[model samples]
Target: MSRTIFCKKLQKDAEGIGFKPFPGELGERIYDNISQEAWQMWLEHQTMLINEKRLSLMDEDTQKYLADQMDKFLFGGDYDKADGYVPEGK
Candidate 1:
């Protein structure tokens, strides 16, 4: 499935597992407010993105951040993982 489609399914699955998407952007925004540990964890996941090709089932920006993180790690390698935020593709 395409990125967006996959992400929607992923979120739906997460909800099924009892994790709601943040109540709103405020509950999710972390750019400059995340703890250092969280940031490091994000970076570690980014490394996985660079090492693998599985698309995330999260929102668009989150998916993009993964791609960018992978790019940074891989030295500008191409990333085709789906942008899973928008629910357009299926």
Candidate 2:
């Protein structure tokens, strides 16, 4: 049976990730509180942030920035939107 969590991002109960995606306390927190659907949403948003900002994954500062953004997107009560992005069919 699949595990479930009360996803912080979507504010609903949903399927949980089977394991921690990151390597520290933040990952643990996510594992305990985030859902797979929310994580997937974050992945798509992260891709947009990377492409829009031209973020280099090899750069430490860029990695830190993305991590900070991830934290905000997940549990900080605020999520960053890609610049000039509009939801479809709005």
Q: Write the per-residue lDDT of candidate 2 for residues 19-41, one digit (tens) a residue.
A: 89887999999899999998998
The parts of candidate 2 lying over 4 Å away from their true place are: 87-90
What lDDT tens digits, residue by residue, belong to model 1 across residues 1-90? 211111221122111212222344422433223333343444555545544545454669766666455434333345444344332353
The clash number for model 2 is 0
lDDT of 1: 0.39
Residue pairs clashing in model 2 are: none
For candidate 2, what is the TM-score? 0.89
Clashing pairs in 1: 3-82, 59-85, 60-85
Question: Where is model 1 poorest over a 10-residue stretch in terms of lDDT?
Answer: 1-10
Q: Choose the strongest candidate by lDDT.
A: 2
Worst 10 residues of 2 by lDDT: 76-85
